[model samples]
Target: MVRNKLILAAAMLSSAALAAPAAAQNEQFIPILSYRTGAYAVNGVPYANGVADYYSLINERDGGINGVKLLVEECETGYATDKGVECYERLKGKGPTGAAFINPLSTGITFALTEKTTTDKIPIITMGYGRADSKNGAVFAYNFPLLGTYWSAADIAIQHIAKEVGGFDKLKGKKISLLYHDSPYGKEPIPMLQVLAKKYGFEFTPIPVTHPGVEQKSQWLAIRQNRPDYVLVWGWGVMNGTAVKEAAAVAYPRDKMIGVWWSGAEPDVTPAGDQAVGYKSLMLQHGAGKFLVHADIEKYVYARDKGASEPGKVGEVLYNRGMVNAMLGVEAIRKAQEKFGKKPLTGEQVRWGLENLNLSDARIKELGFEGMLKPIRISCSDHEGARDGRVQQWDGKGWKVISDWYTANQSETEPLVEEVSGKYAAEKNVKPRDCSKES
Candidate 1:
């Protein structure tokens, strides 16, 4: 009986495996490890919606890239690393193109998948977060922290603040406090910020809060005492609202507090509503609201009333980010198909596509994401296709760009990437694969 049960279980497993490929016979599968209901849901939902919506639009509106549909399946991770791994294992092989690419979106999950992708031969695209050194594609192949990372954000934040204050020299006497989530994601930006503070003679104060941070009264009490010139918010979801409310409670000027892009969204501040007005955030290319392609998305997908997982969230900021994620993923697949011929491309081929992926100003404008993303040209040593970002200010109602595009100080980041990536390689005893001699 036990033997029979084993046979039946094996058959069921085979059936599921076989079924996935057949289901994706003429399509590319992109697995989304989305946490739509979790501590991070306020941010994660819109982002996941945008990603899934874009995939849906591509399949329905564009008729599935050269006659191949894009199949995106979501597995909720609740921002948990272990759940993310489980989802990755379950969905990676089911995709038509060997799971094409993954954007875990969570720093913890990204790190966990960093190991998994290496073994699975898939590309893990963690845009604007994750390990900044993963930009050294030579050292950390299969991991693409595209566009920017926390270090980039920190570098740019300092540069922007300096620009606002005339120069770095003017920052000598100022005190800046970092209100960070007590996790790897929040801590990632510290080294760069501290390095800058030391160079410019500014006082740096660190304030940390546990995740899902509803209790920040004490942290704010410290901030209120220090009364730093500016506060940088490195929070997500409910934490963002709580931080804003706390700032309001302590009578901190809303304008002086700046949020990381993820922290400055509608969901983050909207809960605090008008009370958190004038809050500013750093934007990594795309910001809130609809762009050029959004209208088409609404008409094509939502008008037909076919939503991915969430039907109503078509063109919000996080959703647009998700869409952009899907766009990048699809574009990479398309590029791979250009070289690898067509459907059923392998993970390695997709990697080639990702590394070689280019989004020219003309192309971005053409696609209707002109102002949404800086022109990107990815290569072997650099996985982050672009390194520039803008700042936006929140009116009581919406967001508006307050600054032009600015590149992070690569002079500061290059050495750091090399040092950290090199250490990672040495620790693992892994040598970087040479892109020049690809077979």
Candidate 2:
């Protein structure tokens, strides 16, 4: 019986190995760790679709990035950290040169894979989310929080709040509270906000909400009783919509509440009905609605009926973010091809490309991303390239940009990044790379 079991196990392994297609030397692999069935599905599905569709657009229109065809695959994580790590490990070595890089949509998964990917030499691009301190690329070499970080988001949100209440001087003695999801992703901005509160002289409070966050009456009740002047909502998935609804329930003014880019989406407000009106959130460079890139995605991918998202759902907030994330990766690969001869490149080569990524204004307009992105450049020392964001308010019907773009006060955020990243390097026993020595 033992001999038979061993033989059967070998046969099963052979079959599973045979199922995956043989890798083509000229195809670049991109593993998408997505969550389409979970508490966050409403938001995740659209973002996942956007990611998948952009790759499809490249293949359909440009015949892939610089003739090196993209080999994309999706592994659902259901927003679970363990499942996300499993998906990453399983798909990381699929193509001829292994995965070009990975976009772990979940912050938890990004945290889990950071050390592993460092060993594997694969880049992890967390466009607008992930460890705020990971922006210190000198230490976290393989991590790229490209567009922004939680610390940047925190600073920008406070800047907008300061603008709203007259000036920075007016924040003295003001009460501000943070309604955060009880997880690493939600807690990331706490230290930065604390620093900001001290600097601006505001009384700060943090309230934690359990996962899925469907039950928040107690938290909102406390908010109703205390009535903080402004609440910075750091939430995701159902938590965002629930917070909006609960705020409405407690008679909290929606205008006084602000959310990070993660918390701002149509799904978050639509479920709250009229109560969501006047609610505001930050935009990470781009907002909802279509731009030139959307038109191309429609013409190349959607018009061909090979699109990933539902009809007319292609240009929503999260979907646009996903597209932007994918575009950045493709551009990185293209940038790599400039040096690596355009064939399928290894993870290490892609890392070099990411570290050297420079998206200029002219390049942005040429790539059909004119309005969706801004001029930004990445380097060996700084991984969070662009920290500028705009404020948008949700009307009863849709979203409208209400304020000018506010760049994160780097003088304030950089020192904290250095402190935290320095501690991380010490704990991990890592000798940071010297950017000046890098070619």
Candidate 3:
């Protein structure tokens, strides 16, 4: 009986010893709002997987960032705004620091959560989408359109079109048509496009594709009849694939139609088969393929049989972008830790880190993201640290970068950003921050 008691005590002590390390590890929580079961699932799944895999890599390889274990919980939004809000509300206050930051990944959800994040003292990260004017961080304090925004995209699109037509002056009298998803995500680029059209003296027409964008017979018929010089497709999900097919049905030149970042994934053009060949689109700094970061993910996350993506989909375009998104978040947390100690940080604390983020070229290389990211510097006044984009063309099997990086002409977009953000500040009854006064 005494021998049995000693064994029991020893086992209990052993259990406690194992539990102590886990309990002692400070945790930083990130709430992911994903749409893996909607029309956008084909495009959404890979992105969500990439984000998950990167976090897993950090935990598996580095034992978490500087010893703060990262915790991620996903909630299904189904690409619905209401569902997204519900997910945000349910997960906001979770973990130690109350969700380091929120990546809505949807413009509708970003718009809905923008005010909520401010009230909750959290930051809403909209990496290449959302309201372009939100880059005015002074007015939209909680919103960070990190890498680029729709305005930058629109400006880049026009710049590419100009290059093809010879020069900016050559754009005069040319008809540049926009084929956009009817939602806010698609329409966000119109204003900037219009501003560019007027500046360059080009004919601009905006065409809207209905939600889900499956049925577009009438729209294609109009495109066939109108025969615009260039068609800019601002689509997402299955819409992107369908658009490519519809453009083919009309016998339009695939090379003439350029899609935005959301429309440039594998799923977008694969369904169109050979029709997708020569189809061009914008790259969100990075394109499809693996880098050093992906090598680490394969080594750390996949080797452990815990990867979120499928066997061979790790280096896809959307997946790589998702990894970039998570890397930015992790870097922000690491930056925040510099000021807030080596521990889990609150959302507000993370915001400061995001604002002051400076991802230098050498640092990006060290992080194994050499060709995938540009040197970016975020500030209190400008959340969009990088406003450059590249053009890629589908070569029937995979995407190939076709053009050099084109930096958006901020001289044109800046005035609009100021005007619109000023109006938003007045309507929301929020005073814009004096960025110069901020650290």
Candidate 4:
């Protein structure tokens, strides 16, 4: 009887030892702050879905990076900055990984999180929208606005117009109006556009549209009276549809009206239907759903019933942008794994991964996303990988690329990035670290 007891005790001790290491191995937690129902729900929902779906794919397909399963906990922020802050505080204590990284899909949320992420050491992945200067990694270390900024977008749009008008000199005295939503996100492109206008000797018109811009009688009235040569729409959600309809009502030449990527999405166009034909928009990189990556996503995740959220929006423009968001997030994590040896990586380690993400064309194809995300090379000083973008046009049914990758005149933008980033850093009493050596 004593001998039998001894054997049972030995088995218990062995099991306990095995369980301790297993528990120690599992420590990574990834928090996803999403706003499925909000003023910007039309765009927010799909992007959030893409973010969550990529995490799901990573866990189920790859077995949780180096044995540490990625634990994704969603907190609805409703795209509100306060709610997003609350979500960040709530999720920051989940595990040792301490909120590996966060993708706050809203620009307001991105701004709010930018202030806090530095202390938390959790990188905020603002793939597209945010403070454009946050791309200066040395100034905003924890913020990664991966694909380019409003400044870049605005610059490219102007470049496209210049080429269309024969030359920059040919644009003299031409009127270009900005029909923008009256918000920080909407106003982001103005300074850059004005800078371009000054350089090219074009007239700049600023037209403000209220949030959820449905009541645009005055805005369209102004556009009609002014009769600007070109109209640039910077809006979101229902605002986009409203702008297009109002433009149509004014008999504005659809081709002459250009939209920022966010303004020309399916939800924006589908609501306006045939009226939005021939509308142009500056695509940050990818648009609509013509790329090969769209097919793969439709085949792999959506086909197997493993979509981010809604299965129906697998190939939509905003949906694909969400996919690109996921791609960047995953690639950053994978890059972290290469350095940190795998899962259960700290946020700082992941920040390093994000700051040095190098996605090649071949690798993009291998991951079932070739044309979705441009190959970005991040660094300690430069968090944005591809500062160049393209122009796309809506052809009633879908979008087609109209221009190739064009880098904005950085001589015009870099100083602005530094100035704004410097002001932010000064106000916050934070001295941005010099990353010259790392660069």
Candidate 5:
């Protein structure tokens, strides 16, 4: 009887091993590192929902990308860096394609995964947040900052403020305070802000808030006492709403305060109620409201009750951002298939596709995201294909676009990118890649 049982177990193990390769051959695995149950859950939930829905829409509508289905597995990180790294390790080698790319939603996680991805040969896409200097693709080959970076956001914020105050020349004697979350994510825009401060002759002050950012009485008190000309908020999750409430408490004009992209969502402002009215923020590309693609999602995924999020949240800002992120990932896979065949691709092949991504205006329109994203073309040297963003302001009811699309001043940004990334390369003893060698 013992020998018979052993033989049966061995037969089952052999059958499972045979089935694994067949299953892997038909799907592309994309690992989602998400934070849906933490201090940042208010913002993280919407983004995660959007991402999952987009993947669902692709499978339901297009029958997957070129018939190769996307198999996404979510690992909750709770916005913790250590947990995020663990999630990456656990899911990086799953399925056939093996993690097309990873979007480390938190800057802290992105920083932790930067070196790991380089060694593992997996691409890390930090759509709007990450190490700003990672834009220099020569030094950071496997990382893509995508649509925009913190440096560009800071530069655009300064530009908007300068325009409001007349000009860069008028920035002289002006005081701008940065109320940030006191983390690597919060400190990301400091170097660029300091550079702009020196150039425009404005006083720059950085005030930090502790994690979770519920207690900011002292920070707001400082802002009240200083009465800076404007306040730039670099916060996430609950921190955003709390800062707005404190600003209201101190009677600071909401119109004079601006937040980064992460701080401008419905959850960020809705908590402050009427106090958040007139608050402004930088838009990574698209703002809130449904677009063409959203209609499709509503028809194919939400209406059919196959959506990942609440049907009502089909087109919120973070939701739209998630759709855009998934769209980029899918397009990269499509591009990879152009060369590597329409089958499950390795992470290295996906990297090649990401590097060569060229989404024209017509292509974007065809994909039902015409007004949602600007035409982006990535190359070996320029991983951040688009640098332009618009400004939006929250009225009593909702957000409204206030400025035309503005491009980052690459003259100022490129030099800084080179300086910082070059220093990083030297410290890590990494030899920068030569783009010319690539076909």
Candidate 6:
């Protein structure tokens, strides 16, 4: 009996010794704050799928970034700020590396988490949405707008409009109306738009629509009466479809309507049917369709029955956007591993990687994103990275690139960023970081 007991104890000890190292292996934890439920689900579902699937592809194909597995956990925010905050607080401390960074996805949630993430030393990537001034990284060190900001989007849209109308001088005496959501997200472009309007002598009108934007009959009626030369839409979720439908109802020429990136997804146009054809929106790097990355995702992720979204919806606009967002996150991790060792890294270390990101044409082509995205290089002073985008129009079937990539003139937008961000720093008693000393 004593010999039998000794043998069992020896076997158990051996098993534990073998399991210890495996359990101690490092993992990159990414917390996804998604809104897969509620009014925004139609738009949210595809995005969440793209974000999740890209991370899955990396893990399944390359065994994650540099052999450290990626661990992603989703917390549904239902598109509400309070729920988003709750989700962030719950998942910020999970996994081996502890929430490398967060893509708030929603401008409202981005605003709410800005202070918290700054204090926590975690980065918030608001790619294409959030406080425009957050592009001034000196004051907002923890916030990375990545591809573009609303200010940049607005600037690019205006450039497209100028091209359409002959030149910047042709914009003189023209009237442009902004039909926006009556929230911080919607109001973000107003300051920039105002600056441009004053510069080019275009009459700018600000129209507001309430949240979830289903009822915009009055707003559309105003547009009909005013007959503005161009209408810029800044809406999301059901608001997008409804805005397009209402514009059609008023017989507004679809070609004359331009929406921000968020307002141009599949969910935003399918309901508008043929009326949405020729409806243009800004494309922050990519529009939609299968790129080089999709082939690998199909083989490594969906083929294994591990796709986060339906196979058919893999390359839609928002889904592609999510994939790019996830790609940036993973690349930042890989860059950090180059400096901090090939192991899980803290949020601070990841921040350094993001600041130093240099996705050149060669690197992008190597990553299979060749024509899908413009090359970007982030610096301590420039968190918005590449302030360039293209115009895409929905063609009844899918989105098609309508204009050449237009780079937002930083000369026109930087002063505003500094003025607004400097004001914020003073109000909050925050000191802007000296990029000269960062190294």
Looking at candidate 6, the ten consecutive residues that score lowest on lDDT are 1-10
In candidate 5, residue 422 scores what lDDT? 96
What's the lDDT for residue 417 in model 1? 83
lDDT of 4 by residue, 1-439 (tens): 2243234335433533444545745756777777667688777777666665665566556666666666666777887789989999988766656777888777877877787888889899887788899878888999988888888888888888888888888889999999888887889889888888888899999899887788898998888999988999998888888888888998988889889888767788878889999888887787756466555555655676655545556667776777688777777777888887866888888898898888887888887777666677888877877887788888887888888778877888888889888998899897888797663
Q: What is candidate 4's CA lDDT for residue 299? A: 60
lDDT of each: 0.82, 0.89, 0.90, 0.78, 0.89, 0.89
* Clashing pairs counted in every model: 6, 0, 0, 0, 0, 0
Q: Give the TM-score of candidate 3.
A: 0.95
Error of 1 at 188 (Å): 0.7
lDDT of 5 by residue, 132-191 (tens): 999988889999999998999999999999999998899999999999989999999999
Give the CA lDDT, 0 to 100, for residue 127 in model 6: 86
lDDT of 3 by residue, 315-414 (tens): 9999998999999999999999999998989999999989999999999999999999999999999999999999999999999999999999899889
Per-residue lDDT of 342 in model 3? 87
lDDT of 6 by residue, 1-439 (tens): 2243234234423533444445535677788888777898898888988898898889899988888887777778998999999989988887766899998789999999999999999999988899999998899999999999999999999999999999999999999999998888999999999999999999999999998898999999999999999999999999999989999999999899999999889889999999898898989879889989999999998898777777889899999999999999999989988899999899999999999999999999888888889889988899999988999999999899989989998988999999999999999999999999986
Q: Which candidate, 2 or 4, would have the higher lDDT against the true structure?
A: 2
Q: What lDDT score goes with residue 127 in model 5?
A: 94
TM-score for each predicted model, relative to the true structure: 0.93, 0.95, 0.95, 0.90, 0.95, 0.94
Per-residue error for 172 in candidate 2, Å, reads 1.0
The whole-model C-alpha lDDT of candidate 5 against the native structure comes to: 0.89
- Each prediction's RMSD over C-alphas, in Å, is 5.8, 5.9, 6.9, 8.6, 6.5, 7.6
